[model samples]
Target: MLTDRTDTRAKLWRTASVQRGYFTAAQAKDAGYSYQAQRYHTQHGNWLQVDRAIYRFREFVDLPAEGDEQLVRWSLWSKGRAAVSHATALTMHDLGTASPSRIHMTVPRNFRQQTDALILHRAELTEGDVEERVGYRVTTPLRALVECAAVGEDQNALDIAIAKALSQGLVTQPKLLYAAQQVGPRAELGVERALAAAS
Candidate 1:
């Protein structure tokens, strides 16, 4: 490595350190690494590729690849274009016993990228519907249940999630009802049933 590049690499390392050791290709470029240099570094094991266009410092590459760390890495890979949502948000908020087999995220309608690890739902979210938590953004609890109610597969699980959220004071019946109605009539059934059971 060139001596001059050391400072640039240090800056990139500082950024990646805050993001749980993940940095994107664009971030690397911004930190003065050309595509060729990035490839060389990764090829030489100075950085470890996490996903396409995403890399983690080789020093931190040995960290376990599950739970919140990986979730933060995945979110960084999205380039702030997605917010965790639905069942994943419920799990993050500790509102359910059921764990989703895949992470759930919402991207703007025009955003495109498909991957096996995440189920991406496309919609524009209102500012109030999203909240930042643990260095990443997620849907508000009521919006999470509302989105889950709209497309979630299991009524029993959804009800349990709602009950838990209610008990935890994460959301209220009126707010859930309002969120459901905002998504239209089809979504109302699940929230209504969950509310009934909780009552």
Candidate 2:
């Protein structure tokens, strides 16, 4: 039989793998790590305390995080239910000039993580609307544009993004139209207007 320590290590390892080597105190507790033990591990160099109640396996601590490290930590912060969206996603997909002051993410309507660093929107995204990245998720170009337009992202910027996406095949015209129609009148109007200007 595995010792208690071995069993706990295995459980935490499994949890961290899906989270890009990061795990929360709650998760550690659920995996049989008591609060005191968590402190001990951190003190002993077994786990890196990354943020408030957040820990990372030293193995996956360093990464290509220069621009994206925080994205992973925040993804873990959301417990893995958020996808980079809105202006942040548009920037990631290289579709728009939406350099918002804050990062953006889409979570379930009930997900209420409040922080000044992020702008959280609520929506149920279809699988096709999200693209999985190294340690986080982001909205597809088509979805990002529709979302930005629905929220009244600047018209000229949306137009530029739409034109760029279409030219580079990041989003097809028909697909953009269908997605816009699904969003509502504003999105549909924005997409149609952009398409007309482009064509």
Candidate 3:
């Protein structure tokens, strides 16, 4: 029989548990932990500081795998305003053999976070362009393919990503074409080549 306060703590722990036991300072505040309380937890070794603004509960115990560490940390860094995008989104959607060394994220044009571990693309994302995966937000497969082809310099990689998306029925050629058209001339050439190869 847990008391009300204990139940609140447990609820917060459960929320962070899904995200590799990681939570942001904002989340702590929302869960009724004051700034002083957060510091107290850190000082007492009850919570581990994972990044500049991210903390992990000592007992939450849901560690991320090797490849997911960077993505998870950067996701926390975004504080939910960014969605995984471009090559990283392609990898998340399993649409290509892309192994991006840096995490790619799409933030609104006014987003202001500056970090070295992430490549930021400023875009106005609509609801249809993003999806939640596990506890992270990512661009949809169709949007990811268009983004990869639009900005990616490597034609070979774009070809493979586009082909994978089409073969897997993740997106159709018209969807790619529409997305590319939305980007206008910046994406025309890549989308043309990708369409040819995928079709």
lDDT per residue (tens digit) for residues 83-150 in model 3: 99998888888875857887889999999989887889999999999998666789998888788777
Enumerate clash totals for all models, in the order shown.
0, 0, 0
Q: Best by TM-score, which number?
A: 1
Query: Which lDDT tens digits does candidate 2 get at residues 50-169?
Result: 888989998876665546666788998888899999889988887757467888899998887787788889999889989998779999988999998899888899889999998898
lDDT of each: 0.85, 0.87, 0.81
Ranking of candidates on lDDT, top first: 2, 1, 3
- Model 2 bad stretches (over 4 Å): 1-20, 26-32, 44-46, 58-66
Candidate 3 wrongly placed segments (more than 4 Å): 1-5, 60-69
**TM-score, ranked from best to worst:** 1, 3, 2
Question: What does the lDDT come to for candidate 2?
Answer: 0.87
The 10-residue segment of model 1 with minimum total lDDT is 61-70
Model 1 regions lying over 4 Å from their true place: 1-3, 63-66
lDDT of 1: 0.85
Model 1: how far is 28 from its true place, Å? 0.9
